[model samples]
Target: MVVKTLNGAKAVAEAVKNCQPDVVACYPITPSTHIAEEMNHYYANGDTKTFIAVESEFSAISALIGGAATGARTFTATSSQGLLLMHEALFNAAGMRLPIVMVVANRAVSAPLSIWNDEQDSMSQRDTGWIQLYCKNNQEAVDSVIQAFEIAETTLLPVMVCIDGHYLTHAVGQVNIPPQSEVQDVLPPFKPKIFLDPENPLSLGVYTNPSHYQEFREDLHNDLLQSKEKIIEIGKKFGKRFLRTYGLFEEYKLKDAEFVLVGLGSVMDNVKATVNELRNENQKVGALHLRCFRPFPSEELKKILSGKTIGVIERDLSLGAQPPLYTEIVEALQGTNTIVSSFFGGLGGRNLDRTAIKVLFQKIKSKKPLKEWIAQQKGDQK
Candidate 1:
């Protein structure tokens, strides 16, 4: 099929169409509302399966959880607050191992109640045990959804395809919509290992005390605990068929560089361009863009920066202390043979452009993570 520019919301609905998903349960919210709108339109016109609009984001996920429990493939979409509303049931879905797919449009959580792109919202929920995949562009946003189903179903863990709020969800970009035939050939129809039945009924959601809770969690633990390998495998399969690069991490000219910078989401592009300009001046520097957040790849990260002094830029804050990814990188390299510091910059759409990126790249290796996380970090630390 020919690749084309599509709005992120339209691309999301398009993926659902290609998957021929059995049910779409959703409600309206900024950045995510369009996805539900498009799917509702298609379903009303008989393009795909039944689309149901729930009263709230919570209800939407609740409905999806119900459908998936009944052996139907299901999906939903939401922004920051909407995702928050579904927080309670979120654990239940994964605990039940329903394999639901969700599109998370990144947004700042409110107190001042602003609507803007930020990684804080999703980062806050990282411990919820979802297999989170972050996308830097609209195409990656769409493609991740399709790949999400494969990954989620295989491990029986719900997957979150996270897109930066305005950066991705509102941006227009070229994306090759997988044709119906290819999708059919690839995504096998959903066949649940366990499902709610009437005649063949069995107990589900059975109460478990501390003794069984560990093992119940052990199952959920194993699903995501074993996820790094399966996630890489799914990304490879998606890449082979789609020509889109998906991996534990993506590097730009890191092999010969003495200094490498790292970041995630759309900012990685800016860092890459800055690296290119710096390389022209004989500055040996590169970038490592994180495509996956959950099941952090310690080994791959170490192999890339085993002996090099690298720097990491976080677009979001970690609250109280530390850039989120920075802490993880420090842990990953603690006993290993590598040196990486952290720089925090560009929170809540601060726009860390080429100049800012170049400056960070130039000085990242010299400063510690807390001192350079953002120009703001030093004061906070003091």
Candidate 2:
């Protein structure tokens, strides 16, 4: 393993090369474009066999679907609107159980049209039947991409590795890129269970009537839920091999804390720093980072947040109702005494500083509903 200072996209590209995917489908978009760019460099050097540059995000994922269906390991990366553009193909890939791994440099979807960081793009497709794994930093982003292929190939389901755009994607950080020889032991060659073979032809994605349609959906849902076990198992194996631990969610100084903040992506760095400061001030505060967002980690989350005052910090909202992740937390802690609250910030890549996090904790302590904006604009609202 060699430790190198690299941006999140570059680190991920390195990991992808080490894993040696059979096919790479790339479409350019901000922040996420670097991942494809670096991978193209690998292709230029003859490190990768199949590198496809498609016209659009939709075409990119369509190519991935074909690659995966042909019994080849496939990968792609996109951000915000580009990801949304692949929405239709995303479901098709997951529904067909392609195990295509993708990286989403999480950015905001637009009506006002700003190409900035937010969770809205991926969160909007939370129910698309893809395994969503979020990273807090460049190192985690690289590791997540490596593990994603393992998890996706294991379960025969697609995986989406999400990293905060611009914040982590562009920021240079020290990352340990595992050697191809070492990574080979961790992630073996992809041997697909089924594929489009001419010799033994088989029909895939056949139309089903109302009678079998519901059953098919049920099986997909159940399979996804059961995949949680494999997720945990793979994480443990990775840790044993690499000395780096990962899980569905990571708890930070939560033991005996009365109030805790829950969030994902790069914002957790600020939350952790703020938690340490609050702890020094004799405050019982903690933070939880949701690494695995798709499975929701309900039982585990409920076990930890049973009686604490929970503050959910989200980069995306459901609009006119609860925020995306906050709603999931509320459902998870349904029968518990957890007083759940919401805190939204960092929209359109707005800076969410330590002051904002501290103020969020303060509001949680005072039992005051946190409805104030944490960005450049200050306001009071109900």
Candidate 3:
């Protein structure tokens, strides 16, 4: 392992290079552009095998779909509108069971047009039949990128490793880049069970009549649920080899705590810090950092937070509905006595400092309104 001070984009790019993907297709967008640029540099130096510079995010994902169909290990990166543009291809990639891995520099979607960090970009795609992993820092980003390939190949499902745009993507920190030789031992070459070959000539993603379409959808759903086991296994294997273990979610000071804060992505860092401060003052507050979002981890979450006072802070909103993460946690603890509250903040890169987090903790402790907007003006809580 080699330690280097690098930003999240560069660290992720280095991890991808170590994985030695067969093909890389990307269209440069803010925050995610540096990842593609770094890969291009590797390709120019004859370090990477294939790098395709596509015209748009849709085209970039389309290229990856083609590459994965041919049994090639493929990757791409995108953010904000770029991720939205690839909406159509995202389903096709997942429906076809392509084991492609992509990195999402999580950014806010448009209408107001912001290039800053938020979970809305990836959160919008939660139902698109892909595995989603959230990273808290550059180290987790690098490790998740390396583990993603193995998880994707094992489950035959596309994976999106999401990092908060600008927050982590542009922030430089010390990251440990595992050597290629060690990575190879954990993630070997992609030997797909099926591929596109003229000699074998098979069909994929064909138009299925209503008679069988539902079955295909059902199978995909079941497989996605079952893939959670493979995710855990691969995570444990990686930990054994690299000494850094991961799981569906990370618990910080949750044992015997009366108040718990739940969140994902980079915001959890601030949440954890707030939890520590509150703990010092004997506030009995804790935090849960959700690492795997797509699989949902409802059962595990229910067991951990069943009877506690829970506060979920998220960077995205569902408009007419409650916040996405908060809604899910509510559903997960439906039968339990958990008093769950929803708090939304940091949308479009608004600052979510320790002060805002402490306020969220206090609100949950007092059993205030079930839904509040953190860091927003007082009257904005409608």
TM-score versus the correct structure, for each prediction: 0.93, 0.96, 0.97
- Point to the candidate with the largest lDDT: 3
Whole-model Cα lDDT per candidate?
0.79, 0.87, 0.90
Question: For residues 1-382, what per-residue lDDT tens digits would candidate 2 score against the true structure?
Answer: 7999988888899999999999998876553559999888899999988889888889999999988998999999999888989999888898888899999998888787877788999998889999999998888888888899989998988999999998988889899999899898789788887999999898777799998988878888888888888888888888998998888988999989999999999999899999999999999999999999987789989999899998899888777777888889889999887788888867988877788888889889976546534555353221
Clashes per candidate (backbone, < 3 Å)? 3, 0, 0
Least well predicted 10-residue stretch by lDDT in candidate 2: 373-382
Winner of 1 and 3 under lDDT: 3
Model 1 steric clash total: 3
How far residue 35's Cα lies from its native spot in candidate 1, in Å, is 1.6
| Cα RMSD, each candidate | 3.3, 2.4, 2.3
Show the lowest summed lDDT stretch of 10 residues, model 3.
373-382
- Give the per-residue lDDT of model 1 (tens digit) for 1-382: 6587877878878887888888898887553558888888889999988898878988998998888889888888888788888898888888888889998888777765757777887787787778888887777777788888888888888998888877777778888788778766556677878899996898767899887889988777766868888888878887777777587788889899888887788888888888889989998888888888887787678777777777888777777888789888877778765667777756665666787777777675563443465564222332
Which residue segments of model 3 deviate by more than 4 Å? Answer: 376-382
> Against the correct fold, how does model 3 do in TM-score?
0.97
Error of 3 at 340 (Å): 0.3
lDDT of 3 at 222: 91
